[model samples]
Target: MQSIERPIIALDFPDASTTRHFLAKFGPDAHLFVKIGMELFYNAGPDIVREVRAAGHDVFLDLKLHDIPHTVEMGMRSIARLGVAMTTTHISGGSEMLQAARAGLDAGNNTRPLLLGITQLTSTSEAQMHSEQHIAGSLAADVVHRAQLAAAAGCDGVVCSALEATDILTATDKEFLRITPGIRPANAATGDQVRVVTPAQARKLHSSGIVVGRPITQSSNPVAAYTAIKQAWNLKG
Candidate 1:
């Protein structure tokens, strides 16, 4: 297996204190991607991104912006000012929104954040997808379609489930990163995530990275959890 030096551990916590506590436990050597979701972002704002970066960890602002072209562009421009390493816009938001976000990133003239398109969420299931969301076609087919839209819109990658990674790799070029979430190691509780895979399996399927939250964050010993996962990905090497 290929060795990954630093796996991006998404800090999907509710508050700053919880985030800080986890970071302290993990220590500075841990390669992390601090995911600032709605709750934390609403509370901490752009300052959270700055603080995470100040601590030498890359920040992935997971706002999952899904609005009109102009609004998304303006929002992306504002987010870009925060100096995050990556940001997400929903592929379901359409090509225009994605394009606008990309343009906003270009306008920043700063270290460009890797713009990823959010495909099917890890929490979604086929029944919910068809009945509730009213989306036609199979899940894998939909993911591929959205990924295509993301690529056309100049997104650097897509946030997809590991199950869809191989298909995405086949459909797109190697440079188009596939950031898969819903990663649960063997024997770990599945929790709310429906589409799950092991770290090694995800890597083998050609996923560029995997976003693991509760499995690491909710563990009794967060460091041990992270290390175990890192080892699973062969990052410990």
Candidate 2:
């Protein structure tokens, strides 16, 4: 997996104007990798992606689509036209749905966006997985299984917690992307995430990329927070 020098900032804002304002905090020379999750995407629509790209940043469209294979395929076709660098779907949707989604991306553009399967959400605790989801295995096992399923279905990578990346990466090839969320710096709040890791921990685990939100986006000095996280992530032995 290619190393992501800069952390992917989550633009978990309410509207387009706020999102734009947040990105502007990094200034014109910063070439950022930003995530437009459900809140922002649903509110701002697809045009916000174009606007961000036009500002010289890469977009990770995090709608996390999960549905019947045909529905996901059609939705992905529409998503492909937006020209994002990455997008996600639920791996629990199974191999057929993953394959269908890939087919749709291939149909839409010669260079499809990176199709990342979400193995397990960071908010889901192991106890919750067993009680609520009624899964029979460890959360790590479940995450690895879903990642393998995604790999077999031709997905480029998976959106997993850094806590599970090592196991998932061991099951898949080196080139397979492991883009982890639930990342907080050592000094940051954990928020609602249950499997949070610091930037240094994620980098040590060899994660392909790390997605961070509040530590940067909600900080009084968003740019400084981002720079601190970036420095931590790139710190050498």
Candidate 3:
């Protein structure tokens, strides 16, 4: 949390080939923090993680693991062996599950990756959460609650919306990380994201890290786009 770089790019490609090609565009010596979420990981497996790491970037394997305690613990063991820098499990899975996830990381017999719990997805709006999930609290409150639970359970950090970063940072110790997704540049469209913030805004909220997707991947010059966004984050962070 003290010295983390901003703008962890989501490598949301369809397959291993496309992911490889995308990484190639960044050229050699482009060592940024990258996210290998469900899509690419499911399609490409551990090799994608290895490929990315071999190129000198840090990998955040975003599986968002959720299941029985034993099940999740074993799953985390496997994910940990991949040597990723971070991973996610749903905070809704409860404290037992979160503790088990951390145990899994310890059992790996390798360098443990940071375990970040998912507070809420950026795609889910307040109305959707109320109507579909039957949650009554405001989004920010729920996110803070989830983050607090994660901290109590020994998690290193949590993945939350930048909107909740201010409250979460205030609520928890500065060492606890708040890795925010749903980040868009000031000029970028919201796309499918409902809870969104710009890199500068997230920085202002004291976000530990920001995740950017299409804005960089879809750009003609992804490297340039990523550089600009990272620069924006630097201004406030």
Candidate 4:
């Protein structure tokens, strides 16, 4: 696989038509990622997956699946058929669920999707951790522990905050991929994302990929925003 210098533009668009329109603006040579999340997946289903893949852009299916082992296994089997490049599941679902997902992907005998275990959402905060989720321990420590569990469960990678990237890298193997989301360029609005970092910072920390959504998607010129990010990252390299 070619090394991507820029952050992956995860188009968390609402529906299929919007996604199609956004993708149409970019030519075949454009280096970007199309992230299919719950909103679009719920509306358009696997057809959108085909559309994105047919356009020759890598797709990251961010379904964030969390269920029992049997159900997760079945779901992963179905997801594998779509030929997605990467997919996510919640680490909170435990080791059995993660192992089952891995087994299902292996059974498909297709190009296996890079299974990324989501440690914690960027939208979550310390207060929410204790008050809402009732999770114990400091927020950062909890995230690190969950990331370790994900790795032990045989996940290919983990979706963690850029703030925790260095810690995760230290805890896991050097080759272990860390997909960090909630990335915002300097001076950009953080939006709902609580923990954030600039693209250059994430690259310096050895993050495998960065998932960027609204900062690029909601820009006046989406392609320009993406191009700027790419340029910044390339310059860093």
Candidate 5:
């Protein structure tokens, strides 16, 4: 069995107050790996990241930046100063942009965060990709191709679904990080996600890490919900 890392809880709350209230549920001793997405970051700004990190939790700043090489390089340089545990860029940005993003991280921080490249969003279906993006071939193949690009560009990993994690890992390297989102626990609602899997399913699929949202965040008891999902993710085969 592949060693599953700690589950990253998505802090999908609207503002800093709500985010603080939610994180407080885990108590003072709790140390979590939390995701700060675009919505929250746009509302709360980088101070939210600082606040979360000050509380001893690790942050995955999910900006999903996609831009020209120079622009992305500058963006990553600024983000690196936040001292996040991980951050993301779009693999579609191509190798030059990916490499530029890496150079930015190297220039900015002494201890650089793990840079992950986004392959295909979990919300996007194969049909959607075919009709809208006009990308040929299977979505899995595209994801693997992007993962290869990410690896070659010096990225630490790629953000892919559990459905394609093993294939991407096989195509790239076994040690390549496959941080999967769209993780729904057993019997949980799938929400807007199209390529979804349960926590246990993600583990079985050899996902290196998972990003869980609503199930844990919207639950009546957030800490208990988080614990349950983490347990499910860590369950041995």
Candidate 6:
């Protein structure tokens, strides 16, 4: 919830031990908001989630669940049990699925995680959008549409690109959280992400938080890279 350290460091490593090793660089005193995506969560299981929670930091569990309402609801019962601070579902699954997912969270045994609906992945390009998904509307428009649905479903927010955050805010509540990914620091390689922006740009555009993976995780000096990004996010617009 701190304004300065908005980077939710993505723990994209293979397992929890490697995650623990990488995070150890920040020292035992540091408290970070970490992301446990499919690779690490699947390999390390819920014990990894318990370990991360026991350390006093928060976790954003990014499984991007998309399934029938009943199925998603059942899955969320288990996901909510992890007591993560945030979690994601695909808006492409529609409002029924999202509401069911939220209901399951309400039924969960632990603190409710903020539920964010994924609009479109940052790695997805316009070409891929039209060619594969057959969506002729601009990608940003599609993102906004998905975000709108998220709001109607009572979701806490949407996961979109910084490029779309301002536009999404125009249609949704200012308090509705925007969790933007694809944050590549200035001068960093874009990698697989197509709609990347710097942390400063995302903050200026009013993103609630930015999900940064390789920019910090791959750096030789991860703590320094993470610190630089936090400083950038807090800069005056």
lDDT of each: 0.84, 0.92, 0.91, 0.84, 0.92, 0.90
Worst 10-residue stretch by lDDT in candidate 2? 103-112
User: In model 6, which runs have C-alpha deviations exceeding 4 angstroms?
Assistant: 1-5
Best by lDDT: 5
TM-score of each: 0.93, 0.98, 0.97, 0.94, 0.98, 0.97
lDDT of 6 by residue, 1-237 (tens): 323255899999998779989989998878899999999988999999889889877899999999999999988999999899999999999999999999988889998888999999999987899999999989989999999999999899989998999998899978788898999889999988999999989988878899999999999999999999988987875
Q: Report the C-alpha lDDT of model 2 over 1-237, residue by residue, as the tens digit.
A: 477788999999999999878988788979999999999889989889989989999999999999999999999999998889889999999899999999889888636899999999999999999999999889999999999999999999999999988998899988899999999988678989999999999988879899999999889999999999999988875
State model 5's lDDT. 0.92
Residues 1-237 of candidate 4 have per-residue lDDT tens digits of 323555787877779899878877777777467688998898988998888888888888999999999999999999998898889899999999999988888777679998989998988998999999998888889988998999999898888887888888888876677888888889999888998888888878767788888888888888888877777655655
Better of 4 and 6 by TM-score: 6
- Candidate 2 off by > 4 Å: none
Better of 4 and 5 by lDDT: 5
TM-score of candidate 2 versus the correct structure, residues matched by position: 0.98
| RMSD of every prediction | 2.3, 0.9, 1.1, 1.7, 1.3, 1.4
Question: How would you encode candidate 1's per-residue C-alpha lDDT over 87-135 as one tens digit per residue?
Answer: 9999988998999999998788578888999999999998889999899
Q: Clash number for model 5?
A: 0
Candidate 3: list runs displaced more than 4 Å.
none
Q: What value of lDDT does candidate 4 attain over all alpha carbons?
A: 0.84
Which residue pairs come into collision in candidate 1?
none
Pairwise lDDT winner, candidates 2 and 3: 2
Residue 1's lDDT in candidate 4:
30
